[model samples]
Structures are given as C-alpha cells and as structure tokens.
Target chain A: MKEHATKAAAFIQDEARTNWHDESLWFVRSKRDKAAHGIPEWEQLRELASQIKDHTLSHLDEYLEAFEAKAKENGVTVHWAADAAEHNRIVHSILQEHNARRIVKSKSMLTEECGLNEYLEEQDMEVIDTDLGERIIQLKEEPPSHIVMPAIHLKKEEVGELFHQKLQTKKGATDPQYLTEAARQHLRQSFLQADAAITGVNFAIAETGGVVVCTNEGNADMGTHLAPLQIHCMGIEKILPKAEHLGVFTRLLARSATGQPSTIFTSHHHKAKEGGAMHIVIVDNGRTTQLGRPDFRNSLKCIRCGACMNTCPIYRRSGGHSYDSTVPGPIGSILTPGIDLKKYSGLPFASTLCGSCSDVCPVKIDIHEQLYKWRQIIAEEGHLPTAKKQSMVMAGKVLSRPGWYKMAGKSARWVTRWLPRPLIYNPLNTWGKARELPEAPKESFQEWYRKNRSAS
Target chain B: MSKAHILKAIQAAKPVPCPLPVVPVFEAETPPTREIFGSVAAQSGSRVVRAEDFVGLATAVRTIYPKDISIATPLRAIQSDIDLQQASPADLNGVDVAVIPAQLGVAENGAVWVTEADCVHRVLPFIAQHLVLVLPEDRIVRNMHEAYAQIKIDDTGFGVFIAGPSKTADIEQSLVIGAQGARSLTIILI
Candidate 1:
C-alpha cells in the first residue's frame, strides 16, 4: 500500500478540491462547536463519558459475558469471532442456515474491516448497502471518504451522474433532493425484497440486553424492521454496562458527529421481530491487541462519531482515503498502526499534532498524544522512512554537541546570506518546496543574548 | 471456542479496573416547557401542531395531509386507510402517512419515544412517506436523562426515539430531507 504522504500528495494536487474539502469539514467542526457550547455541562458530560468508557474497557470481559447471558434470555442468538476471517465465516454460516440470498445492510465499519461484502459476493449472494452515503459509494465502487458522511468527498454533480447511469435518474440533474428521491425509490424495492438485514451496533446495553442503532436517515430501522432475519455486528468494545448510559452517549453522539441534537432515529432492539430471527455477532478482530497496548487502548472508547476527523487539520486537508484504513483520521492513525505497524507507520506522521481532535472527541481520547506516541514506537521498530530516520539522526548529533551545533548554525547563516535562491531552494529541500526561508539574522539568538547580558 | 479465546485475551490485556463515574442529571435553571419542545422540533425540520383533544388532532391531520393519501394508524379516533393489524411489513410500503402515538416527548430535542406496541408494525413509522406522531403535551420530559428514567426500554421488542424526519446530507453536504424513510414529520400534541 502507498504511504500516507504519497497518497496525500496526489490528493492535494487539485488545489481547489483540497481547499473545498478543508472548508467543508471546517463548517462541520464549527457546527459541532456551536452545539457543544449550547450545553451548559458539556465538559462534565465529556468527563463522564470518558470515565464510563475507561471503566468498561477495563472490565470488558465481565460486561461481554453479562451481555451474552442477558441477550440469550431475551431470545437473541449471540456469536463471537476472534478475527476478521472468523467474523466473515460466522456471518456466512448464519446466512446459509436461513438460506438468505438477498441481504440489506446498514453502515458497519467492522464489516468493512472484515471485507464482508466481498466475502459474501464471492458466494453469489446479493448484499445491498442501505445507507444513502454508503449506497452511493458502493455504486461508485469506492470506499467511504468519511464515516458519518460517506460521500462527503464527492460533488452532487458526480452523484447525479452516477445515479443517472445506475438508477436511471434524470440526466444532468444535480439537485440533491431530486437525486435523493430517486435513490429512495430504488432502495425501497431492495428493502422490501431483502431476506435479511444487517446493522452496526452503536451501543449495546448489558443491563437490558439490547443493541441501539442511531441514524439520521432511518436506513438501519427500515432494513431491520422490513426483513425477516436481522443481524447486528459490533466490536466487543461497544458494550455499555447499563441502559441509562445511553442518556449520556446519545446526547453526545449526534451533537459531536453532525451538530444535531439527536439522530432522527435511535432505535433499541431487545428481541427479534415477531416470527423473525435476531443475531448479535461480537467480533474481536484486533481490539484485544490494542487493549494490550496501554498507550492506544483509549482509542477503543471511540463511538465512531467522526468528530476527530472533522476537526483534524491534517485529515481535513489530506482527506480520508489518503490514510487507506477502514477508519481514516486522527483516531485511525493511532489505531491502524497497532494492527499493522509496518504498513501504516506513516499514518502517525500525517498529523500536525494539533489538539483539536482530542478536544472535539466526546469520549476525550488523547488522539494527538497517541499519534505522537505511535511515531516514537514506529521509529524504535525501524518502520520510519530512510529520509526521516537520517534527518533525525543528523539532528540528534548536531544538537548533542554544542560545538558542532554552533559551527553548523554559522555555516547555515552564511550559506543563506550568500547562496542564490535556486541553490538553496532545490528539489532536495522538501521543506522549502512550499515555503520561503526568512532572511538570515545578523547573529544567532545565543550570541545576541550573551552580548546583551554582558553589556547590561 | 471463539468466545473463550476472546474472553481469555481480554482478561490478559484489559487494564486495571477503574470506577465508573456516576452520570448526573444536568438541570436547567428553568425547566424546558412544551414551547421549548415545539421550537426545538421546528429547528430539526419537524412541524409542530398543538391540539386540545383527539378530535382537534384528527382535524389537524386532515388539514395537513391530502385527502387521497393512504394513512396507517393504530389510533382509535383517527381513521386509517390501512389497518396495521392486518397489514404485513411489506404491505405497508405504499402508505403515504403513518400516525402513531408516542409514549412521551423530550422537550430538549423534540424527540418522541415510540415502541412496537404503538406502531403495531415495526416498519410503519419509517416506511411511510410522512410521519405524524401524536404526543400528549403533559408527557414531555426535560431531557434524555429524564426521558430514559420514565420509559422502560425492554418493555417492547423494539423502540425508537424519533427526533425528526429522516434526512441526509451525504450528497456534497447539502441538506436533503427524506432519504430512504419519511420525508417529513408532524408532531401533533394533544
């Protein structure tokens, strides 16, 4: 896989698109700020949410067992998968048992990580993504650019064209309302004919043995209710100890995600529909490994609100696809490296270490701090690029020796004063490519300080 | 076996236990009222109608929706074109409007709590093109904390907090109401 820098460079080639993407995300960030400011006890809410998640992660095994036992009492089947391959196999077997061919699914990042769509399609089963953004990207044959707004990267004109070709919508109609209507009519048919429905769990309450799915478009509810068979896929960390925790999380989730007071539909499922089957699959793909890393375990507290992505300067400018992970943002940068350090080592370096992501995070995961920590680990593991390693080595040497540092500083000042622009600003100087160095000072700050102090 | 493996791994990797923080109710200086609920509902793109009784609610519903539209409901006062008791989930696809009773209303976010018992068919609220929720004005709560305290989530197989009409901004962040579910929501408070 291409590293983040190379992919980000290609993404930023279109200056207009880059600026538009950055501003669009900034708008969402601003909306989040407004909503958060309106709440009188926002900080207290964040603290409570963070503490709740920390407690749950520490006692995850007990909660999972309790959740399973309660779900069984509720007449819901529970399944567990140790890894991605096992998750895919377990879901397939469930489908096979029911002989379900046509499947409708709501947004589940876990399934994306497990490549469930490709796995089921290989078996000649028809799987349809029901979320509007997800369906758009599925038809366009691309991964989601944003988790909450999956098609945020694409323009309406592009979406209109895609729908025109696939759904037979009116040609050249770029109106979102018109295009959305066409998709609604098209997906309604899929929902009615679907033999089974799949949804992602937003929060699973062990107290009541229910799973909650929140959505603004109601796709999750539409699919799960219409189909005879229902399945919910969740990472084990999604478990909450009690149902009242929903009050804290539900208040924070939509406001943090899109600045809405609440999602249009926050549905809780305790049991299967009358005469229908309900199954919950608890999958631990790499979460246990992450839990082992004390530095990154807090990342599991993420509610998948995408607040970090919206507020991140690097994420806004570089775009989500540049990270090349199931989740692509500040949180993804910290979490993905744990999954495959060698392949995702460059992701941590994509950040500017701006604390906006951490501040915006409802659960208050120290996202930027975790990114910094991952960089240190990457360097120690020898996963850093040769150029970065060499530069850091040279910097370390020059800084440790005062004599060498002074000599280097003098020569650098001399060179900048005398050398031509072409010589100093060459292709080899990556930092100088987009910036111009300030004029060399008459003397170094140390020399100026020493002389002035002595004179005083 | 997979469950045991996952549990063992979690046991080994999980951190030291931390005490769960007690979630507290955030009380407003002045408690939210039905007026606040109506305003908040309007902000989220839902139409709010205040009615004195069931007869006024029926009149408001008739005035708002077209006469030829197919309506589905379990309400005794409101005449529904489609009988939810007899209609299957798929049979309710053509419903133009669905009027259902909400157990309670949240004043802070303009959300209404509805369970399967209220809709009869689980898909009625979403499958219909428009949704009309009949909430009693006296049943409004101040916030989510108060809302959860009042309702038993496990009382029914399925329940939802319907805040507004189903909407999406996926197409270039353009706000478009009515994406695969109801296009508009009208809250009739009786």
Candidate 2:
C-alpha cells in the first residue's frame, strides 16, 4: 500500500484542493459534534449501541441465518459474499439475472470499497451513479473524495465544463442549480429507463428483513420505485435487529452529517412491492474480521456518518482523497489497516490523532484511540518506515536512562542551533512541511521542573 | 470475514439447518406505567402531550392536524383520506409525512423500528401529507443491545423503528432533509 499511498499523495498534491475538501468535510463533522453532544442521552445511547453490536457479533451466525430466512420469506433474495471480489461478482450475477444493461445506483460506500461500478463496467454493464455528487465525479472519471460529497474537489466552473462537454450545455454556463437540475432531469430518465436499481442499505431491520435507503434527492426511490429489479448492497454491520433504532440513528445521522434536522428521503424496502424483485447482497469484506478484533470492532457501529472526517483536523488539512480508500478520515485510518497492512500502512500514521472523530462520532467510536492502536500494531508488524522506527528507538534509549536523557537534551539543543536548517528539515516526516518546526528553548522544561522542585 | 461460500459449502455438506430462532415475547402484560413523559416531547419536532383516552387523543390529533386536511385512525386506514384504493405508488408519490406504529426500539442507535402492522395502511404513511405517531413510551431503550435483547419478541405484523424523521443530505454537499417520505413529523405522545 506504500505504492498506493505515494500515488494518492501525488493525486492530492496535483489537485490543489485538498484543503477545501478537508474543510468542507470538517464542517459536516462539526455539525455532527453539535448534534450528538447536544443530546443528554448521547453517551448512553452510544454505549447501548456498542453493546448491541457486540452482542450481534457474538451471535452473528444465528442472526444472519434468521435474517436470510425472513428476507427470503419477504420475497427478497439474500446473497452472502465473503469478500470484496465475491461481492462484486454476486452483484454482477444479480444484474445479469435480469439481463440489465443499465443500472442507476445510490450511495453505498460498500460498493465503493468493492469497486462495484468499475467491476460492473468491466462486465459491459452501464452502472450510472444517480446521486448528484456521484454523477459529478463519474463525469470527471474520478473517485469521490468525500463519501457524502463525491465531487468536493470540483469547482463550479470545472463542473460546468464537465457538464458542457458531456451533457452539451451552452459553453461557459456555470450555474450550479441549473446544472444540478439538468443533471436531475437527465438522470430521472435513466431511473425510469433502467431495468434495475442498486442502492446501499443505511440500516437493515432484522425483524422485518427490510433495508432502509436514505437519500436527499429521492434518487433511491425514483430509481427503486420505477425499476423492476432492485439490488441492495450492504455491509453485515448495518443490521440493527429491530426498527426503533432507526429513529435514533436517522435523527442523529442527518443532524450530525449536515446539521439538518432530518434527511429528505428514508425509504424502507420491506417486502418488494408486488412484482419488483429485491436482492440484498450482505458483504463482509473484512467486517467480521474487524468485529472479532475487540479494539477495532466499534468501527462497525459507524453508520458511515463521515462526521469524523468532517471534523478531523488532519483530514480537513489533507483531504479525504489523501486517505485513498472507500472510507476515509479518522475512520478510514483504522479500517484501512485492518483490510491490508501492506497497502494501507501509511493511513494510521497520517492522522494527528486528534479526538475530533470520536467527539463527533454519533455512535461514539473511540476513533483516535483506534488510530493510536493501529500505529502500535503497524510498528509491531515491522511496517513502519526506517526513519520513524529509528527515531522511536533512540528516544526510548535516551528517555529510559537519566544519564542519556540529560546528554540527549543538551545535544538536541546544540544540534538545533548548529545543524544546518536544511539538514534539520526531515523530508521523511510530513510534519516538517508547511508547519513551522518550533525552535528549541535555551533550557528544557524538565530542567526547570527539577530546579523548582529543589528550591521548594 | 468468513466467506459466505464457506457457510454455503458447510450447508451443502452437512445439510444441517440453522437453529430455529426463538422469538422472545416481551409482552409481560405488566401494568402500564404512564408517570414519566418521554424525550419525545423534546425531540418530536412537534407538540407532544399526554391524553387520557381515544376521545381526547382523537380530539388532540384533529387539533394538531390542519383544518384543510382530513385525518384517520389505524395505519391501514389511510386510504379513506384520498381515493388511494386504486392509486398507484407513482400516483401516491411526493408524500410529506407517514405515521406508522414502531415494532420496537434499539436504544443503541436511537432508532425506532416501524412496520406494516402499525401503519394506517400499506401505502398510508408513504403517501400522505404528514405523519403523526403515537407511541407507548415504555418502548424506548439505552442502546441497540437492549433493543436487540428485546427483538426476540414475535413479529407477526409489519413495523419500523423511526428515530426521528426521514432524511438525507446527498446533494452538492448541501444538507436538506425531508426528501421523499415526509416533509414534517408530529409525534403525539399519548
């Protein structure tokens, strides 16, 4: 994943809009914080939710079996996928079952992780992302930088140009609302024409064997309501056992995500209406592995509420695209390493370890603590860069012994004054770039503390 | 994640049916506790006040509803408000609110599950002007585990656990709620 990180860094540097992307998401994160902490019962709610997920994880085999049976009885086909590859294949098979050439899809971050659209394209299937932000990025032929706001990197002019070229708009027309409406009109036809609709499950009620799809544009409904075949993709973690949880999550989800009191559309596809066929592909894709690991399992409670990303200082500065995964920001930093240590080794280290993600987390996942844990795990696995490991070892050796600590503190002061500025600057550390390296004081705080202690 | 195929293969080799689920009946017939008002009064985004019986509750529902529109009881009884008997879903599109009975709660996520059983009718809430849900307060929980703990109950009817109102913010980063389901919700805490 070092290679991918390099590529992602290069991509981000070239975009020159990482800060804007970061800040935009951070704004959402702040709103989430306001909403979540605003509730007096917020912390209690989080604990209960966490315990429920733990309980679910322990008896997953039973719940999944029950869910499958109930869903089948409700006329929804349940497909199980062990991994991303299987998930993509199963989705394709479902589309093929109906010989659907064109499909309109809603926002399902799981599909992004599985690379579903690209895979379906390879199979000669036309899968158009109908979400407005998704459509913008799809037009640009880029991955969504932010999960909720896919085209956060694009400016109005850029979007106008893309629309002009693809949709043949009048040259230089940059009206966002007009372009959005036009896209809506254009996509509505696709929703109507498409034979199948593929959507992401927000929360699936095990009791009813139904999946809930939340959308602002009502695209999920426009497509699913019209399309004869519906394909729903969801992670195993989306299961919430009962329905009342929807009230808490839906209230908190929108408010935390964007400070909205509620989301525009929250449609539940219970038993498929009449002749419409519904197929749910529950993809694990490292979730149960994540679930079994007690430390990282709380991440499963994430409703993919990108609030943490929105509020993360590191994410806001570097941007979601910098994380280079389906899920990004503080949440991604932890989830990525669990998926592949080699590929996503840089993620955990990328964070500033600020507690904003956890603070803003509606379900209260200890995001920063997990990031810290991932760092130790990575270092233990020998994935740390040589320079970081060496620095840590040297610091450990000096700090553990008083004699070396005194000598090291004096040497560090001398080095700061004498070493060439260029030599002092570490290209290996991202912290050195842009941010000012604080000058070493004439005396260390520890030295002052010792003197004060003696005088007292 | 254990590959689903592994489970599938296990099923094929052993032909062992998964354990039959035991639906824990939470219906203890305990005396109804009506002393405390729930957080609904605060979060309902509408007026929530207690009522003694059907006469006062129905009277309150009528007062809360606009004079121009009609109201009805029973989730399945929504068809009388309009000639929706033959109205297709497309015809019933652009509904503002839906009031359906919640099956239970998963305090974990602050969600309230609802189902077909609690609605005025199948298409009632999804094809209406607004929704007003009257829930029994004892159903609330601390988190999802507590909710899950109680989910072993029988589900002989349709239900959903609505946390707040239907919502989303998927537009050009603009956060707009009340998309397809209901533009507003009025929870009458009876």
Candidate 3:
C-alpha cells in the first residue's frame, strides 16, 4: 500500500469535501466537549479508567483465566487466538459445527482487523454487516474509515447513489432518514434469517464473565437477540478486572464518543439465549506487543471511543481513509506501527504533536507522546525515507557546531532573499509547496540579542 | 494451546501490577432529580411520562400509541395483544409496541435497566416498533455508579441499559432516530 501522505494528498484533492469532513468531525468534537462539561467528575473518571486499565493489563493472564472459567460456568465457549489467522480459523470451525451459512455481524474492529468478512466469504458463507455505516461500506466494498462512524468518509449523496444501485432506492434521493429506513428494512431481513450473530465486545468483565456491547442504533442487540447462535469477538486488551469498573468506563465512553450522555443501548451478554450457543473469541493480534512497550501500554486503555479522531486536526482534515488502517486517526497512528513498522512507518509522522488527541482521549492515552516516541524508534530502525534522513544528518552536523550553523543560517536567509521564485518554490521543497516562505530578516536573534544587551 | 501461549506471553510481557483506583460516587450539591432525567431522556429522543400509578401508566401508553397497533407486555397492569412466551423471535418482529418493566432507572442519562426476565422474549425490547418501559420512581438511581451498585448485573443471561429510542448519525452526521430497533421509546415513571 502507498504511504499515508500519498493517500492523504489524494483524499484532500476535493477541497470542499475535505473542509466538510474537517468541520463535521469538529462539530462532533464540540458536542463531546459539551457532554464532558456537564459532568463534574469527567477528569476523575478518565484517571480512574486509566488506572483500572493499567491494573487489568498487569494481571491480564489471571483475568483471562478467570473470565474463561466463568464463561465456561455460564455455558459459553471461550476461544483464544494468538493471531488474526487463528481467530478466523476458530470462527470458521465453529460455524462449520453449527452448519451456519448465513451470518449477521455488528461492528467489531477486531473482526475488521482480522478481515473476517472476506475470510468467511472465501468459505462460501453469506456474511452481512448489520451496523448501518458498516453495511454501507460493506456494500461499497471498502473498510470502515472511522471505527465509530464507519461511513463518515462518504457523503449522503454518494451513499444515496450506492443504495440506489444496491438496495434500489430512488435514483437521486439524499435523505439520511430514507436511506436509514431502507437499510433498516434490508438488515432486518438479514437479522431474521441469520443463523448466527457476531458482535464486537466493548468491555469484557472478568468478574462477570460477560461482554458489554454499546451501540446508538441497537444493531448489536438486534442481531444477537434474534439469532440462535451468538459470537462476540474481543481483543485481549478489552478486559476489565471487575464489573463495577464498567460504571467508570461506560460513563466516559459515550460522552467522549458521540457526546451523548449515553449510547442508546448498552447490552450485557453473560450467557447464551435459551437453547442457543454463545462463543467468545479473545484475539491478541499484536496487543501483547503493544502491551510490552511501556511507552505505549497505556494505549490498551482505549475503549475505542473515537474521541481522539474527532479532536485530531490531521485526522479531521485528512480523513480516516487517509490513514489506511482498520482504525484511523491518532490512536491508530500510534498502534498501527507496532503491528508492522516498515509498512506503517509514516503513520506516526502524520501527527503535528499538537497533543489534542491526548487531551480528548477518554482513558487519557498519551497518544501524541507515543507518536513522538514511535518516530524516534522508526528513525533509529532506519525506516525514515532517505531524503529526510540525509537532511536530518546534515542538520545535526550544522547544529553541533555554532560556526557552521551560523554560516548555514546566513546562507539560507541570503538564498531565500535573492533566489528566483521558481528556484525557491521547486518540487524538492515539499514544505514550500503549499506554504510561502517567511520573509527573511537582516539580523539573527543572536546578533540582535548581543547588540541590544551590550548597551545594558 | 493458543490460550497457553497467549497467557504465557501476557505473563512475560505485562507491566508490573498497579493498584486499581477507587471509583468515587460523584456527589452533586443537589441529588439527581426526575426533571434532569426527563429532560435528558427527551434530548436522547425518548418521551418521558410521569405517572402516579400503573393505571396512570396504562392510560399514558394508550394515549401515546394508536389503539390498533399490536402491543405486547408481561406486565399484568398493562393490557397486551400478544403473549410473549408463545412468541418466537420471528413472531416478535410483528410487535408494534412492547411495554416492559425496568429493574432500575438512571437519572444521569435517562436510562432504564431491563433484564431478560423483564421481557420474556429477549428480543421484545429491541424488535418492537415502539418500546414502553415502566420504571418505578422509587427505583431510580443517581448515576451509572449508583445503578451498578444496586443491581446484580450477572443475575440474568442478558441485560441492557436502554437510554432512548435507537438512533444513528452514520449518514453524513445526520441524526436519524429509529435505525434498526425501536422507532420510539416511552418511559412511564411511576
């Protein structure tokens, strides 16, 4: 795949759509701020959530064992997958045992990470994404652009056209209500006929051996309750030590996500419905690697609220599709590189180190700090592009010697002042491509400081 | 085997154990009130009705919904046109309105806690075109922390905190209520 910058450039070609995308995310961010301001204990909740996650990650092994034992007691099957391939295999085997060919799925980023829908399709099973945004993208044959708002990248007009072709809606209708009603009818049929339901776990409580799934539209409950067999796929990091901790997380989750006081439905599934089977797939998929990094272990504290994405300037302007990961935005920038450093090296550099993402993170993941750290690691591992590496090398040599630095600075100012516009604004000057060079000063700050202070 | 491998990896790579922080019950100057819950519920797209008794709740439900719609309920106080126990998941799909009892009500977000036992069919609360939750005024709590403290969440196979009617903003951030679940939610607090 191409780098994030290349993808971002392509995404920003349509200035009108890019500004709309940016404003839309900022609107959500403003709503989040309003919801957060309503609660006096918002910061306390973030701290408590962070600490609880820290404690849980520290004792993840015990929690997993406890969760597995209790789930077994509740008559639910617990499967562990060290990787995405194994996770998909386990899901397929279970489907084979039940002879289930038709499946309805709620939004699960873990399943997206595993490419479960594609894998199931390869096995000749009919898999449907029940979330309205997810269903739109599934029909459009693309991955979710944002974790929460899967179809945020697509305008209503585009969706209307896609539905016109796929769901046979009116040729040019652009009403979200009409489109949503059509999807509701279309997915309701899938839910009713589904042999199995698959959902993503928002929080898996070790004490209760249950998984909680939150949704604004109640698609997760619609699918899980109607289907005979239910499967909840969760990343290992989703575990919390106790059920009471849910109060802290849930209070923070929706408020941070869509700025709602709460999601429309927060369903807790402890056991299977009567005479039906329940299965929980705990997949690692490089979470342990993230957990091992002390600088990044706090990232596991994420509840996938998508708040960071809403608050991120780069994410808002560039669009989630620009990141080219299952999860896109600040959190994804830090997390994606750990999975494959060479391929995702550009992600950490996508940030401006503005720290807005960290400020807005519900669990207070130091997202920007981690992005900075990842850049260091990438450079140390020689993943930095040659042009950047050579320039940095030249910069370091000049900066280590004051005389050379002075000469270089003086020459740069002279060159900018005297050079022709085309020569200065050439293709090699990527920073100058979109920005005009600042006017050159006759005297440096050091020269001015010496002259001014000498009189004193 | 993967479980063992995963457990071992976690054991080896996990950070030093940290103490879990105490989650405090935030005390506002004034206790959470019914008015707060009602307004919040309205914001979330739910109609909140204050009733004096089950009779009043029944009247409110009847007043809000059309008389010809198919209503399902396990509450003896409210009349039902369909039997929940006999209704299969597919059969529940036809229910126009479902009135169910809530174990507890949360004042902070206008959410009502309903367990599987409250609705005989697990799908009743979601499958219905409109949802009616009868929450006793005395059972309402201040917040999620207080709500979790009072109830046994694991007592039933399934439970949910229903805040409002199902809604989504997936299409260009447009707020559209009644996505795939109930088109409307009416909470009758008695």
C-alpha lDDT values of all predictions: 0.93, 0.66, 0.92
Model 2 misplacement above 4 A: A1-19, A418-432, A437-439, A444-456, B1-190
Chain A accuracy as TM-score for every candidate: 0.99, 0.92, 0.99
How do these models rank on DockQ, best leading? 1, 3, 2
Worst 10 residues of 2 chain A by lDDT: A1-10
Task: TM-score each candidate.
Answer: 0.99, 0.74, 0.98
Report the number of clashing residue pairs per model.
0, 60, 0
Q: Model 3: DockQ against the native? A: 0.89
Q: Candidates sorted by lDDT, descending order?
A: 1, 3, 2
| Candidate 3 TM-score over all chains jointly | 0.98
DockQ of every predicted complex: 0.91, 0.11, 0.89
Q: Write the per-residue lDDT of candidate 1 for residues A45-98, one digit (tens) a residue.
A: 999999999999999999999999999999999999999999999999999999
List where candidate 1 sits over 4 angstroms from the true fold. Answer: B53-55
Top-scoring candidate (DockQ):
1
**Residue A162 error for model 1, in Å?**
0.9
Candidate 3 lDDT over residue span A137-164, tens digit each = 9999998999999999899999999999
Say which docking band candidate 1 falls in.
high
Q: Relative to the unseen true structure, what is the C-alpha lDDT of residue A16 in candidate 2, on a scale of 0 to 100?
A: 51
lDDT (tens digit, per residue) of candidate 3 on B53-88: 435877788888966378999999878888777778
Return the TM-score for candidate 2, rounded to 2 decimals: 0.74
